[model samples]
Target: MTTPANRWRDTPDRYGLISRLLHWLTAAQVILLFGVLLAWKGFGEHPVTLLLARIGPHGSLGAMLLVTTLLRAIWAYRQRHHRPPRPPGVGGLLARSVHLAFYTLLILIPALAILRQYGRGGHLIFYGMELLPEAEREIAWMMAPADLLHSPLAWLLLALIAGHVAMALAHRLWLKDGILARMLGSPQATRDT
Candidate 1:
């Protein structure tokens, strides 16, 4: 198999180098994790317990998302480096904030969930090994705040993702703007298209 070139294009340039990679990669992980979580929760399984069982083996993958999210956040702070289209205004600012929140919650949700499990004498499976802690916990009371954070914030993330997709579509249809295309390498009419 051949490797793809470092992809770029002028006009509302494709989310820049780092942003594009982080955007898609985080998207995939979020969707997978979203499915795992919704399946577990919608079925009335204790979300934490269910995740501890299912997502336990995917610890490293989750960690990767965390790292990627951080890197993406940093890149987002300096997006002008790629010199893309004109940035968004107040509306865009709000939308961007929502997206950032979504990313943050994704990282915190799994991490705290796992740590909650560990603190509560639960098993974490990574690479098919029962990745349990060797050190014992003296206090058994765990999963309290993690459980509190799980449901409500999860619902919030659901809304954010929905709105994000809707905004992208709005940009495509209503705004007739370059928002979506720029992210996907559509040919633009101008350098800052």
Candidate 2:
């Protein structure tokens, strides 16, 4: 049986509760953010899209995502030595590179957005809380990086996420590997793998 302590911390065979929680939470936020964007693009100014926009404004969702990603990164670093091992050889190298990129983009995307928002001299409201008051003048340099790269980088991040999901599914269905189980299954299920 999985002990209480083991459930909250990473093991060599499976992810701990905290890790799983953060992972899934982050995934949910990403999906919601993307869904809103896609809906806006596809449906234009439909009532449903307008409602979604109000409920989950782009800035608010991005702020939440940024916080979650940062927390996940910190937890992952702490659990680095205890988490499940990566695949051997070339697969491991590729996995490592992809993960590094994932972390980089996850942090960068929202960070750039926040920077841009501030540069525009607009008040920053996160979940009804005012985080930044409006400035007297816009800072062009502060906004430049995000204005130039935000959309392009966002598209690239989407592509990376797609590849990540495909690989996970491939591992579970085609390779019959326990990789998916490591994160999705109970500790007992992964211990034997």
In order, what lDDT does every prediction score?
0.65, 0.88
Per-residue lDDT, model 2, residue 156, is 93
Model 1 misplaced stretches (Cα beyond 4 Å): 1-12, 40-61, 74-80, 83-88, 129-134, 138-142, 187-193
TM-score of each: 0.70, 0.95
lDDT of 2 by residue, 1-193 (tens): 5688788988877889999999899898888888889999999999999998888889999999999999999999999998988889999999999999988988999999999999999988998999989878999998999999989999998999999999988887788778888788455344334
TM-score of 1: 0.70
Model 2 shows how many backbone clashes?
0
RMSD of 1: 5.4
**How does model 2 fare in lDDT?**
0.88
Best by TM-score: 2
In candidate 1, what are the lDDT values of residues 1-193, reduced to their tens digit?
1124435312234554456667898888777666765566577567565665465334655655677787777767766555454556887678667766876887787676677777676676555666566337634456676767866876787788888899878878787767677676544443323
